[model samples]
Target: MDDRKKNKEAEKVTITPSDESTSEKGHLFGLDETIESIKDAISDFESGKILNIAIIAPSYAGKSVLVDEIVNIYSHEVTKVSFSSIITDKEEIPLSEDQSKIMIFDNCHYLYMRKIGGFEVLHAFLNMVLEQDARLCISTWNIHSWNYLGRVLDIRKYFPVQIKIPPLNSSQMKEFLLSEYEDGEILFVNDVEAEDKQIFHVVKKPLAEKATHGRIKLYTLKVNYVALRSLLMNKGTPDETAESIIIKEITRISRGNPGVAKKLWKKWLEYPIIKTSNIDKFSPSINIDVDSRFILYLILSMGYIKKCELNNIMNWKCSVDDIRINMILFELLNQELIQINDEYYSIRADKLHLVTKYLEDCRLVW
Candidate 1:
């Protein structure tokens, strides 16, 4: 393999360990390319020139994992310091030659706003990197926020080399599943392996449905692959007589969020005989601003809310016009917090659960 390919292999191995005991399968999937590019970039830094690399993508695109892997691989060769949010002057951790080697700031997108002194700590840190000329600073952020920060911070002239980590495409998703699951051969029985698509499309139907009234869909296979690997490792795979229904059900619940998938999968192992229908009991509702409640309620009610029903429900309490609801709904969709198609709006269930719960506790659920 070429040096690039070799680096990719190293990145892959670092993500999923050969020994199943210590691995979190989520790390292994959807990152080799980005990691390889980052390693190569780090190599450039080691040769004496400083480089500020940015990892930009949508939320939950695994930016943190990418940074962690790169930091781990080049721990000794470079100095690594990381941050997630805006740094206050008092909270600022100075980056010095002795303390600074390769700096990895996890969420540089948080530095856009002006605080007392305006991202004072981040400004100082970046200036330090510029003056020192020996530090390599790699940072990650949601692409939208990154764009705003880039414009505000004049990031173009400062950190010219930006690397964008695209979300997991279908092909990457399949590879991720195979690497995580033992029955990789069986799971991908047809040409369409679990990793066959960028997003794993699984139905989100309630148990009693023969034909989904209005189906909810999730990329559960990809989301929960890492969590599933961990859970399966704990319980041991089923024998010939054992069923794989639990695996499918667990994946469905995860809807492709690693954190949620892992949590739900772990809970599943504790009680393996649970039914898919019972999964609903384990789910939670999220709380968001009341202005955004109508659409959210529609989503929580299982991805399809009739316009007439929504209007009737709202008419009982508030007079939110259709235009207002439509506007806020569009905004949420843009944020990837919700998805709408064919006159139906569906909450990104993963985010909805948490946001809804918060709103309810705050008594803001509309």
Candidate 2:
């Protein structure tokens, strides 16, 4: 393999659940209440009441990490089966004749597709869950897919206990990111000057109507509303440290999603030190046709998918061939909206929210 392909493989290995131990996976930063709820549901299941759980969260928001933590808690009894691609048939599911009473299915959103006749496998799986009175099923789903399925199939009824992962606050984010490091091991540098860090800036834009044949420039003052709000909220706190500021900015940019925050942390960190100016502030604007939008939605829904899997989904849903799918993937990769690692494509971590918002605006995703 080429160097780029090797790097992609390495990244895939790093993020793979099997490659990391329970402690190395992720800290349950803001999920204490969620964990407690799942534990209660498990207890009820053990007591003859099969209270199945559906853990819902957006992609890269630590759905798998949460599932891993749950499995660790019930290591002796829980059996976890994580899906990395769509399951076109019910038989593809790995629910074996195991003695374990608790079954954890991660990425349960893969059970169905958005196309016609797509719910057959999911219906079958649900039926199986209903028939298996002795087994308790705990499934996880992409929030968008769960919403769509809820509207269409009323899937929420199948899972009695629904747990939505909550976003972490600034302090929680700091603790989660710093959990892997020793105290004072990592440095937070505020390299930008105070004046440079102002919440408002002047920008030049092209005039809507030019006075002459030549182009005209218009100067306007633009305010960073998010930064302004942060400043206003922290106005009374003058003793805040650079670490606090960096974590706050990270929490703001990542929208408190732990996976995104972790990726941002990796991007900004330069060994033991990270600077405020290194934080990513650039947002990619997505403007694509309906077909591309649907493809993007598929990637977001599945989390990580191979090109062949995309081809299969497109063939079933839209009758689009591999070449056209490749073109669309190329366009998305060029736009930095999606990335490929070891032939598996997923929404770029930094662009996850941006792509989801765009899809929502287009009504492609709920």
Candidate 3:
């Protein structure tokens, strides 16, 4: 594999012997509440509560890290199975034959198809988990796939205790990233104001009370109106420091995602110095057309894609209707929203959050 592929692989969550231990390496910021919740669920399960867990989080949100810790803690007691992204077959997930009463599945989303309402493997897996009383199952899924499945199958019903990991704040982000480096080794440059920001054109969406459950749906079309209004109208200009500005920018661009923030930090770091003046915020000017948007979501859903992969995904989605694949690819290439390396097209790490935000605004990130 190439260096790029190696780097991508490095970004993927993996299990190590140290992860199974109560070492400092397993420590994570802003996850105390989540860890407590998982412990409580485990306690309940031990008490014959049968509350299997669904650890739901967005892509690259450290779901695997958390799950690895859990499995490491219970390695001697439970059976563990991890699914890979390259998986295209829906084979039967094997059961443990060593009389283990608990099982843990990572990337349970891989069991299902990405198409709308396509849950053949997931449905089977859920049945297997729900039907058997001899085994207690803990599964994790991508937030997007979970939401889609919830809409179609009410997936929450299967797992009574659902743990939705919350995003970290600026302070948490600082402490988290700072753990990787020593004091005075890195500097943050802060900037003020929202003047001359790039404009992103999005399709105006209409929401009914039944559809959105609240009036906030009306505010979906206004991009960052809350933040922009606060910055321009309510907030006062004070003496800003480099650390504060860097944290804010990191929080904004990464959307409080740990993985994305780590990648951004690596890119921004210039040996021993980082300046906000040099940090260019990439606020993408999104063109929210349906076909292009759908294609982006499908690609994001899977880490990387080939033409054949998209065809398989569209097969389940029934979305290959009157759309020119070549034209869309060309347009995306021109826009630089995605990058193609050796015929395998993938999103650039720097633009991950921009693409995610665009898809989220389109309600495709869910």
Candidate 4:
């Protein structure tokens, strides 16, 4: 056999689908409210009022789509400039524009770092926009990063009209599923179990007896890219690969952050498949070497069964090591995906709901 085929066969992993229906894009039922909000922002700016608006929230909070919708719908007047994973060169920012122009810069956080050496140029660009009565929309993961932009770019004068895009609620999730996945599956109304402590549900829904810090986390952009790419890679033909199914399922586990979802999906894809039912089966067990993106996912699953501690999980059939646990937990805590309480940590309730139905669709959880 060819080495490549041997390698793939050696790494063969098993995944379960929640259901036949899940979406792979758009505003399922309608993001009219969100779309209108963007249009309103544009209207306010086009009326000779120079505006600096900041779209802030956890990752997967739909900041890019919100602005993208505006740009897509009003392409004549809106100019889209993306700054993701690229060095920000201030000179490259479009500065010469009339009042009718609406400039959208996605991922502004990468630009304000002192290391980039482009903050001053960005400041100059913003100034030019204000002077020309043009509107500028900046997208970022959170408002905290804006402090860097403020310090370097002198945006305090603008104070940036902040618009918070909250994660999708249950109704919105249904719309998302309809738009992204196929139709005919039900959205989650309650959490369900797969087996033992392997809980499955949407990322934004409440799990059975889950502790809450009253918050939700979206995946980081890097994590999202990883997950989406992994899904595409595994499925091979874009046919009925488990990647899309994993996407919906992990969405319940990872919420909407493409990064976290990607990691978990990859891990799930990489998990060892020990035959259980002759039809090919593998029981979900904690294992080391899971990508850091699934830290919150493991933490969230703890609630499905009591007495499953962090240390014990490392020893499960999944073969998770202590070092991996420390690393994953540390990353989750740093990202605010999971908050530490007095002794235990819990997944953000909002995120749990987001991917709940996805899990159900994959049949990963009950």
lDDT tens string, model 1, 1-366?
A: 021123322221122222322224366665777777887877787787566787775444455566656655655544434432233452445445354466666555444332235456567656765776656777665554455456667765667677877544434443443444455233211222234222333645454355654464433333444335435553664331112444454444444444344445445332323333333433334334665764554344322333444444454334547776666666777666776544545455355455545545655342
What ranking emerges by lDDT with the best candidate at the front? 2, 3, 1, 4
Q: Candidate 4: misplaced stretches above 4 Å?
A: 1-31, 86-88, 97-100, 114-118, 134-144, 147-159, 184-366
Best by TM-score: 2
The candidate that achieves the highest lDDT relative to the unseen native structure: 2
Clashing pairs in 2: none
- 217 Cα displacement, candidate 4 (Å): 36
What lDDT is reached at residue 347 by model 2? 95
* RMSD in order of candidates: 15.5, 4.9, 9.2, 18.5
Per-residue alpha-carbon lDDT of candidate 3 for residues 1-366, written as tens digits (9 for 90 to 100): 131243344323333454444434345778778878987887877888888889898765777667656766665666656665434544546644545666777767667667655567677678778886866777887777788779878999998889987888999999898886888778664443444232333444557767677554443443544345435643574455677777777787788888778878888887677766555644668895797888888767655567656666666333444256767877887887887876667666668877877888889876
Better model by lDDT, 3 or 4? 3
Which scores higher on lDDT, 2 or 3?
A: 2
Candidate 4's residue-wise lDDT over 55-150, tens digit each? Answer: 664443445556555555665665555543223356655455433355666555444433334356556655664665435554443343454345
On a 0 to 1 TM-score scale, where does candidate 4 land against the true structure?
Answer: 0.44
* Tens digit per residue, CA lDDT, model 2, 1-366: 121233332211122333343543356788888899999998887888888899999877877667777777777677767665678878777655666778887777778877777888899888877877888898888898898899988988899899999999988998899998999999888776475447889988878655643478789998866467767898888667778888988898899998898989999999899997786766757889887898999988877777877676666345456568878999999998999987789899888989989998998887
What local distance difference test score does each model get?
0.50, 0.79, 0.69, 0.44
Q: Which ten residues in a row have the lowest lDDT in candidate 4?
A: 274-283
Candidate 1 overall lDDT versus native: 0.50
Ranking by TM-score: 2, 3, 1, 4
